[model samples]
Target chain A: MATLTLENVTKRFADGDDEIVAVDDVSIEIDDGEFLVLVGPSGCGKSTTLRMVAGLETISEGAIAIDDEIINDVPAQRRDIAMVFQSYALYPHMTVRENMRFGLEESTDLDTETMDGSVERTAELLEIEELLDRKPGELSGGQQQRVALGRAIVRDPSVFLMDEPLSNLDAKLRAGMRMELQRLQNDLDVTTVYVTHDQTEAMTMGDRIAILDGGKLQQVATPLECYHRPRNLFVAGFIGEPSMNFFDATLEGDELVLEGTELSYPLSAPIREELEGETELVLGVRPEDVKILDEATDDHAFPVTVDVVEPMGNENNLLATFEGSELSINAIVDGMRHVQADERYAARLPESAIHLFDRSSGRALHNRRIDDEEKLLETRV
Target chain B: MTAAERTESGSSEGRLATTLETIDSQRAALYAVLLGLIAFYLSPLWGGLTTAFKTQTGFVQTTPLAPPTPEWFTLEPWELAFATMQGGLVNSLLFVVPATILSALLGSLAAYGLTKLSWRGQIGILVLFLAGVFLPYQSVLVPLRQFWSAVDLAGLLAFAPFLAERADLIELTVTHTAYGIPICTILFRSYYKTLDDEMIEAAKIDGASAFGIYKRIILPLSMPMFAVTLIYQFTQVWNDLLFALVLVTSRSNYVVTQSLNELQGSMAQEYNIQMAGAFIAALPTILIYVVFGRQFAKGITGAS
Candidate 1:
C-alpha cells in the first residue's frame, strides 16, 4: 500500500566504554507493494535492520519514511505496522479468533461486529475458520503459523514485517507456507520486509533481495541478478546454497595464474584488457556453473581430483580439488551422472560463466555473460 | 497365553520382582518411619481440636488427646471463644483482603516495569527493591510504630473525628501493603522475567500502548503467578503479630492475632477457649491453602 524507505539507517549499542555498531549506515528504497527480503548470515544485522523498520529498535542514525512521511520518531503502536515473529508470539491464553481480533481491537476502534467480521474473513482466507475457538496450545505448529498470518492480515496495515516466521516449522511445512505467504502478499499487495538467514528463502520469496554482511549492505537486486552478478564476494557466497567457489589469482599478460597451483586460465584478449593493470583479482564461479568434462577440452578446463562425492536425490554435489592441491571446489552435476572419488575429472570454469573480482577490495570486475535464453527469461519475469 | 508368552522372555514383572526383593526391608522400614512422622505431626492438631470441643469438667477429667464424649461435650467454650474473637475477625478481614490483593497487583506492575521496560538506572532501582525484601521487620519495628503514630490519616482524608478509631485499621492496611510490596515485587519479578520479550514487541507493533499490552497480555497470563503471590502475601500479613502488637493498643482495632494473644491471661488458663480461638483464627488461611495449594506449587516451581 505504501513505499518504504530506509535512508542511511544505522543502529548502535553501547557496552561499557565501547559503542558497537550493530547495523551500519545502509539505505534501501522499496517500491510500493514490493516484497523485500533482508537476508544475511547470523550477526549480519539483517534482523536489526528489520526491527528498526518495525520500530522495535531505535535508529542510531538516519531516518525511515513511509509514503514520503518521516516515521523515525513515531512510536511502534502509532506506526501502523504488523510483525509476525519467529515464535509467532501468540497470546497463549487466547483462542485463535481472539488472536486474530486482538490487533483490530487495540489498533482500530472498530465496533464488535466489524472486528468479528474481519477476524472471520481473515480466518476463512487462511482456511482456519474451524480453528477459531481453539487456543494456541491446542493447535498444531502449522495451524499456529496460519493463525499468526491471520492475525497480521486482519490488521491490514501499511506494511508487513516477518522475522524468520517459517524457521520454527518443519521443512515440508516451511516450503508450503513459503508459497502461501507469497500468494497472500500478492493478493493483499502490502509492502513487506522479511528477514531471514536462509538463502533459499531469500532467493525464492523476495521480489528483491537485500544481502547484508558484517552490518554493511552488500547488494539489493533481484535473486537472479544476485546469483549471476553479485555486487561483491560476500553476496556471491551468501546468496547461493553450497555457495560459490572463489580462487585468488594475479593477472600476468593474457594468463590469470591461480595461486598455489600450476593451472593458468588464458582469458580472451577483451577480458584481459578489462583487467586494466589490476594484477590482483579473484575468480568466482557458482558450483552449478562448473561443467564436468570427460577430458580436458581447453586451457580453461583443469583436471580436478574428486575428493568426495555427495549424491543428492536431484543433483550430485561433488567436492573436486585441483590435483595435489589443498584447495577444494564444489560442483553440482546431474544426479544420474556417474562420478567417483579419488579420480581425476576435467572440470571447466567457462569464461562466459566465471566472475572476476578485485582481490583486495572484493569488488566485482566482471560478471557471467548471459546469453539470449536467460535474457528472454529475464524479460518475461 | 499372554502370560506364558512372556515366561521365556525378559519381562517388566520380572524386573519389578527383582527390584522389590532387593529393597523390600529398606522400603518397609522407610514407610514405617514416614508413618510415625505423620502421626507425630497430627497429634498436636488432634489435641487442639479435642480440647476446643471439651467442656470445663470434661477437660479437667480427661487428657487433652481425649475426644469429646457426648455426656461431657458442650458448645459453651466455642461460643465464648467466638464472642471474644468476632470483632477482631471483622477488623482483620478489612485489612487482610485489601492488603493481600493490593500488594500483589502493585508488585506485578512493578515487576512488569522492571523486567520489560528499559530506562536509565533501572538496574539500580531493581537493586533497591530487592534490598527491601531482605529488610527484617523486627529491625524496623520502633520506626514503623513512630511513623504511623505521627501520621493522622483521618485528617488527611478530612473525615469526621468520630471515625478516627476505625481509621487505625486503614493505617494497618496501608502498612501491610507497603511492607508487603518489596517481597511481592521480587516474587512477581522472577515470574515475569520468564515471559518472552518478543510478545511485548509483537504487541507494540500490533498497536497496543504500554498499559494496553499489560492489560491484554501480561495480566491474563499472570493468573498462576497471582495465585502464588496472593497466597504467600496472605500468609505473611495474616500471621503477622509483630506489627499488629506494636501499632495497636486499642481493643476496638486489634487484629485477630492481637485478640488471640489477649485471650491468654497472666497464667496459662482456659486452654479450651484459647484452643477454639486459635483454630478459628487459622481457618481462613488453611482454607486458602487447601484451595490454592496446587496452583501455588505450580507457580513456585515454574518460577524456578
Candidate 2:
C-alpha cells in the first residue's frame, strides 16, 4: 500500500509567445488503499496531474511522492507503478497471456513458474481465462478492458493509475466496468488515482472526489461531503447532478432575501457572528432539497411558473422560472400525478438545506464536516 | 385461376432472366481465357527456357513451336555454365553479395535514424535522400566518375602503405558500392513509415535503449521489407554494366554484366558457351526471387 502526495505541483506548456498553465500549484494527499478521483471539465488539468504522478508528464515545479519518497527524478519504469491507459494500449501482436506476462518477464525478478501462476490467477480473477491465447483485436471492448486491468494486476504495483479507462465503452459496458473497478480496487486494496471529466464517475467510484477548475483544485472531500457541502462556487456548481440552483441575494437583519421573497435560516453561531448588516450573499440550494409546497403554505414558499417537467421514472425534474433566474429542481414526486408546463407552484426551502456563500469570494459559509470528523479521529487516536 | 396462373408465369420469366445473366458471365469468362492464352502462352520468355537448354545447331534446325526431342537435350551447356573459367557466376555473386549486405545495413540504419531521432535538419536529410529517387543513374554518371577519382586520390593519400601495391583495382571496387546506397535508403525509409508509433513509445517506456529497440523491435518486425530490399539490390548490382565497364578494365575484375558484354565482342565467339554464361548470370536473381517471392509481395503491399 502506498500513500501518494502532490506538493504544489504545476505544469506549463509553451504556447508560442506565452506559457499556458495546465496544472497550477495543486496539492493533494491520497491515503493508503484509498480510491481518489480527479474530475473536472475538459482542459481542467486533471489528466495532467495524473500523468505527473505516473511520471509520464514532467512536473514544472514542486514534487510528487509515493509512500513519502520523492520520485521527481525517477523514470516511469522504476517508479513501481502500473497504469491503464484510456486507449487500452495493449500490444496488438501479443496474445492475452503474453500481454499480462510482459512486464513481469521484462522487469520483475519472478521465476517462470511463479509468473505463470500469477498470470493464471489474474486471468481467473478478471474472468478472462478463456481468452488467454487470443489477441486484443480479436476480443470485444469489455474483454480488452479486462486484459488491460489484468496486465496491471499481474504487476502488483504499489499504485494503479487509470486515465478514463472506461470512457471508450458504451453506456451499459461503462456501468458494468465501474462496478468491477470498485470491487477490484477493494479486493486488491491498491491506492488508485482515476482521472475523468465525468462527474458521475467521480462521485460514484471515488472514496474522495477532487474537483478542479482552471488548473487549480477547488475542493477534495468524500463524495457525500462534496455533494452536500461544497467549499466554493466552482465546486458547488460542479459536484452535484443537474448542479445546484444559485440566485442573487442580500443579507438583511437575520434574513436572506431573493426574488422578492425573504427566507430565514439559522446559521451556526460562529457563522452568524461573522455576517454584518446589509451584506451581499448568494443563496444556493440543491435540486432535491427544494420542495413544491401546497397553496395554503405559500406564505413561507415562493411561487414560480414551471417551464418544463422531465419525467425520470423515479423522480421528476422541474424547470421553473422565478423572477429572472431559472431554477431546475429535481424532486421525487408521485408517479401518477400530472405536472403540466406553465403551472404556478410555491417552492419551499428547509432552513437546514439552505446554503449561504459570500457573493464576492464565492466561498461557502459552512465549515466542512469531514474536517471535523478527521480532527475527532486524530484526537481519539 | 386465370389471374393466379398469370402471376406464376410472370415469376417464371424473372427466373429466366437470372439464368440468362449467368450464361452471359460464362461466355465472358470463355472469351477471357482465349485472350489469356494468346497473351502469355505465345510469349518469347516461355520458349526461351527450352531454347536455353538446346544446342545452337539444334535451335536453328528445329521448329520453335515444338519442344526439343530427348536426344537433342544435352547437358553440355549446363556443364559449361558451371565452369569458373567463364567467370560469369563468380562475377554475379561478388557484385551481389557485397552490394546486398551493404545496402540492407545502410538503408535500415538511415531509416532508424530518420524515424527515431529528434535532431534538426531531419527533413532536409530526408529530402536529400528522396531527391535521389528522381534522378536516373545515367544523369549523374559523369560527375560520379570524377567523384570516384577524387575519392581514390584521397584514399591513396590516407592509406599509402596499402595503395602502393594495387591501388587501381581497390579503387574500382569501392566506386561500385558508393553509387548503390541512395535508392536502397529511400526504399527502407518509406517502408518504416507504416509502423505504429505507439509500439516505439512502448519500447522506450519498457527501458529499451535506442540500439536495443532497433534490434528487438524494429528489426524483427521489418524482416519482410529487409528481404525485399536485399533481393532488389542484388538484381540491380548484378545487372549493372555501365558502371562496371567504366570502372573495371581488367578481365579478372569484370562483373557478370561486363563479362557478358566482353564475351559478345570476342572474335570467333562460342555461341554455346555464351548462352551458357548468359543463363548462369541470370540464375542467382531467379533463384532468390523463387525463394522469397511471397515475402516480396507481402512487403510491397504491407508497406503501402
Candidate 3:
C-alpha cells in the first residue's frame, strides 16, 4: 500500500516555439487504499496528471511522493505502478494466461510454477478461467477489459493507474464493470488514480474525485460534497447530470432580484448572512431542486410555461421558461408526473436549495447545506 | 429464429446474385489474361524440359516445341549437368546460406534501433542506412573489389581458420551481406514501425529492458519478415553470375550461375546440357517460392 501525493505537479509540452501547459500546478494527497478519480472534460490534463503519477510523463515542476520518497526522476518501470489504458492495451499476441504472467516474469523473480499459480488465481478472480488459452483478439470487449485488469492486478503494484479503462465498453457492460471495479478496488485496497471524462463514473466510483479544468485543479472533495457544496460555478455545473441551472441575479437586501426584477426570490436569513456583501450574483439550483408548486400564492413562486418534458425512467426533466423572461430552467420531477409542453405551472426556487455565486469571479458565495446522514445513506447504495 | 437459420436464409440469395454478377462481368477478360499469363510463364520451362530430354539428333531435326518421343528421351544431359554443376552448387550453398543469415541478423538489429530506440541523431543514422539502399551497386563494384583486396590481409589474418584458404569466398560473402543489409533493413524497419508502440511501452513497464524486448517480442514477431528476406536474398546471391565471374579466378570457386554459363563451350554449344544446367540451378529458388511464397508476399505487401 502507498499514499501517492502530487505536490504542485505541472506538465508542459513544447509545441513548436510555444510551450503549452498541459497540466498546471496541481496538488492532491491520495491516501493509502483510497480510490481517487481524476475527472475532467477532454483536453483538461487529467490524463496527463495520471500519466505523470505513473511516470509515463515527466513532471515539469513540483514533486510526486510515494509515501515519503519523491519519485520525480524514476522511470515508469521502476515506479511499481501498473496502468490499465483506455484501449485495454492487452498484448494481442499473448494468451490470457501469458498476458497475466508477463509482468511477474519481467518485474519479479518468481519461479514458473509459482507464476503459473498466481496467473491461474488471477484468472479465477476475474472469472476468466475458461479464457486462459484464448488470445486477446478472440475475446469480446468486456472480456478484454477483464484481461487488462487481470494483467495489472496480478502484478500487485504499489498503486494502480487506470486511464478510462471502461470507456470502450457498451453502456450495459460499462455500468456492470464500474461496480465490479469499485468492488475489486475495495477488496485489493490499493491506491488507484482513475482518469476519465465521464462524470457518472467519477461520481459513482471515486471515494474522492479531483476535478480538473484547463490544466488547473478546481476542487477535490467527496462525490456528495462536490454535488451539494461546489466551491465555484464550474464545479456546480460539472458534477450533476443535466447540470445546475444558473441565472443572473442581484442581491438587494434579503431578496434576489433575478433577470432585471422579472423574478425576485426571497433568501433565508442564514443564506442572506453568508451572502451579505455580494451585489451582482448568480443564483444556481439543481434540476431536482426546482420544485413545481401547486399554485402561485407566494412572492418567490412564478408561473412558467413548460417547453419540453424529457421522460427519463425514474424522473421527468421539464425544461420550462420563466414568466416575463426568456431564461429556460430545467426541473426534474417524478417520472409518473403528467407534465406536458405549453402547460403553465408555478415553479418555486426553494431558498434551502439555492446556491449563490459571484458574477465576476464565478466563486460560490453560499452553497446549500446537505445533511450528512442522508448523503452517507445515498453513497452506501 | 435460430442464428444459423437466419443467416442461411437471409443472405444466401443476395450472395449468389453478387457472385454471379461478378463472374459475368469479368468472365471473358479473366480467362483471356489467365491463358496469356500461363503461356507467357510456362513456355520457357516447357522448352527447357523438352530440350533437356531430347536426343541430340532430335534437337537438330525437330522443332523446339516437339514433345520428347520415347526413343528420343535420354538422361545424358541431366547426367552431364549434375556432374558439371556439383562443385558450383556446393559453393553457392556455402556462400548464400551464411550470407543470408548474417545479413538478416545484422539488418534486424539495425531495424530494431531505427524503429524502437530513442536517441539523438537517430534520423541521421537511418538516412545513412537508407542511402545504401539506392546506391548504385555497379558504380561501387570496382571500388568494392579494390576495397576487398586492400582488406584481404586483415581478412586472412582474422578468418584464416574459418575461410581455410578460400579467402575469395569470404570476400564474396562479405560483399553480398554488405549489399543485402540496406534493403533488408529497409524492409524490416518499415515492418517493425507498423507494430504498436504501446507494446514496447507496456513491456518496459512490465520491466523489460530494450534488449529483452527485442529478444522476446521483436524477434518472434519478425519471423515472417526474416523468412521473406532470407528467401529473397538467397535467390539473388545464388543467381549472381557477374560477381562470381569477376571475383573467382578458378573453376572450382565458380558459383551455380557461372557453372550454368560454362555449359556452352566455345566450339560447340550444347543447348540441351545448357538448358538442363539452367533448370537445375533454378530448382532451389522454385522450391523456396513454392514453400514460402505466401509469407513473402504478406511481408512485402504489409510493409509497403
Best by lDDT: 1
Which ranges in model 2 have alpha carbons more than 4 Å from their true place?
A246-283, A293-296, A299-310, A321-346, A349-351, A354-362, A365-381, B1-210, B223-253, B259-304
- Docking category of candidate 1: medium
The true-versus-predicted C-alpha distance at residue A183 of model 3, in Å, is 1.4
For candidate 2, give fnat to 2 decimals.
0.15
iRMS, model 3 (angstroms): 1.4
Off by over 4 Å in 1: A373-381, B1-23, B55-76, B156-163
Answer with 2 or 3, whichever has the higher DockQ. Answer: 3
Which pairs of residues collide in candidate 3?
none
Please rank every candidate by DockQ, starting with the best.
Answer: 1, 3, 2
Best by TM-score: 1
lDDT of 1 at B73: 88
lDDT per residue for candidate 1 within A239-357, as digits (tens), equals 78998999999887789999988879988977876666788999998999999987889998988988899999789999988876777899999999989888889899999999899
Please, what's the RMSD in Å of model 1?
6.4
TM-score of 2: 0.73
lDDT (C-alpha) at residue B287 in model 1: 88
Each candidate's lDDT (Cα)?
Answer: 0.87, 0.74, 0.85
